[model samples]
Target: MISKNFYYQLITRVLGIVVTAIVMAFFFLKEYNALGIVVAIALIIQTSLLIQFTNNTNRKIAHFFNSIKNEDFTLRFPENLDIKSLRELNSSLNMLNSMIQKVYLKNEAQEKYYQEIIKQANIGILTLNKKGHILFVNPMMENLLNYKPLNHINQLAQVSEELHRFFSNIEPFENKLFQFSNEREKVQLSIKSTSVMLNKEELLLVVAQDIHKELDKNETDSWIRLIKVLTHEIMNTITPITSISASISKFFKVGDSIKPINELTENQIKSTSKGLDVIKEQGENLMDFVQSYRTFLSVPNPDKEPISALKLLDNVRLLLESSNTNITIKTIVKPFDLEIFADEKLINQVLINLIKNAFQALENRDTGGVITLLAGINENHTKYIQVIDNGSGISEEVMSEIFIPFFTTKNKGSGIGLSLSKHIMRLHGGSIIVVSNDIETKFTLLF
Candidate 1:
């Protein structure tokens, strides 16, 4: 109907123009005809009215587009336009405006959610541009940094160089440690970063978490465990010794004072000697327990150096093979020249520990099992060494306790192997991760 309206409008204008021209021609050429004059006047008036109608419709269309550009969704058109085509165009514009309003509301709601999450997040977070300009510093960041509302990443330079360095050159998917003092309070923060583009501007969305309290809590827990173990061992030794010594004292009789040791029977003497011997044995065991605790507590500082990963694995393989000739060792290094910066001797010890663990996991197999040593760089360019074993994997219950010093599942195990490995990785600014399944147990050292 709208298309037909447009067609009729065009034809009407053309016919009116032709009629007016013919009437003017007759009036001028044939002296004067009243009817021709009247008809020409009428035609002119009709064309003027048509031009005004076209202008009104054009004005309404222009206004509708202007409203859209200005984001004025409230601007509404009346549905009673006389021209069918103009009315249909108005209806379509109104519909489009309604959809835009709905979309705008939805976006507003989503933005609100984002703001709430950012504000309440526990981790210190901020968005920074390539130029190091900071934006959207969350409350956690303010508290963590102890900075008066930061305006730029460089503002952290006022706090400490370590803090400044962290926000300045952060990379995508990077996890880094930053230590610095804010006033008198020293802070150890773990900084992580991700890349994002918001409002067509590239940003580094960084998070900083002050792990000082967490470390303190862990230290407290370790101390508690050590105390518990010490208490248990001491009580086990001292209780028996105390009972035996008391029994020996009963042999002496006080006649005015005390009985002479020379008057004791052979059975009493034998009993006393046996008790002392037992005490001596228990004392020796207690000493061994204390010594193990000392070894566990006094992990040597790492002597870090750049060492080829393959060579490290090979050294570990040679060491393990020399002791246990039955287990097969397979070393695989991707881009075999991959180098890890760590304490060569310490890293070797860690590798030996993990490989030995893998071998032990496979020990009971009827067929000699293979221990796999793998080295590669992850997508984030982190160097990793994995030791894999196809054995009965670790149980969930045992896995959780494996890294605790003196916690173990095997007989004759002192249980510090995994714990010590973890300590070495931390010293070298890396981590150790373990994954166990029915198929295999994998221990990965990430650097």
Candidate 2:
């Protein structure tokens, strides 16, 4: 390539001759013939070379510009050419290529990061352009719609009415939500739709959050209130009969002692006494059952305090340990020394009940299966305490009723342990959720 400095020098030499000719034309007119011939030949050669150089430069410039326009970053300026200006052009082009590559890589990484973040999220996200065509859909959205995103956007409309409502609400800057349900399950989804202006075009972004569990909880609470009403009504009807029976028996006994009648009255008093005793025993049993129900209903407010988690676990272990050789308890504490606010006594009771139930679950086994306690904090900053058991796992049909009062798998149970524990956690502003599979059953306490 020719250097810029060398080209400038050649142009300088040409201008110098032109200046000399103009000077001689004015100063030496009589000796013009021989000098004019030699001067004319020198001018022709310089002009011809200048024209050829200009054409070559123009063609090379055109080719370089064409290569860049074609997006061909791999093309390079020819090496070892005599053109000096081309060297400087090559250097500039190489720097531009490096900058472009760096920008491309940076943008690629940003896109990948955005995709990973969206993929990990539980919420479903979908985006659409102004023409109502789906521009982008994350994996969560794909799974939610039950269709491949690469498929036509129209296919989504066939599966979900909530999706249709979401798309319709995107226009006019309005927010909307819809409910979707099948025979087996129901879902309440809170949906938000908004138009985003980018490069003079409007796009839509839709975000959906699942609120099905909240709906189901509300339904459960309604059922619990109904049960409370029925229990209260039954108690009201039984208390008067129980009081009347006791008073009549007392009167009969007093009359028997007076000896107003004969042997028949004595026999009647004996029979009445036995009947009274039986009535009292039955009444007391019913009241005891009612008292258990009352305790479950009157859930106490939590006086939350910060306590060492390991200490609470130790307390639970000490409280539940028995002399039975078949029962074994193992506890493993994580290295985290984090503090949390909760009702320690209530939490201890919850653990004790869970451990007791786990031990009971292994009745048929030669030796009780291991029951594991695990504690950890989730990425959402929620504290999770889990009781995992390897005993006979609960079947799916009965799993749903485990939290309901008087629903028990054991024959002699009051059926209020899990129910009471669930209420206590609710009072403490937490939750107890159970997940059971074929091999294991787990109760997760989330705070």
RMSD after CA superposition, every candidate: 4.9, 13.8
After superposition, the stretches of candidate 2 with alpha carbons farther than 4 Å from their true spots are 1-204, 207-271
Q: List, residue by residue over 49-131, the lDDT tens digit for candidate 2.
A: 76776676677667766766665667666545565565665666666666776776798799999989988899878777756
lDDT of 1 by residue, 1-447 (tens): 655776787688778888788877888678677877887888788888878877877797788778877878899887787767778767876887899989988998999999999889988898888888887789999889888688897788888887787677778899988888788688888989899998898889888898997899988997787566557657867999899988877777664567897889999889989988988987887777667768767878888788998888888887787666667888999987888888898888888888888878887886758889999988998889999988889999878667877666676656678888898889888999999998899999998
Give TM-scores for every candidate, taking all chains together and pairing residue i with residue i: 0.75, 0.49
Show the lowest summed lDDT stretch of 10 residues, model 1: 225-234
Q: How many steric clashes between backbone atoms does each model show?
A: 0, 7
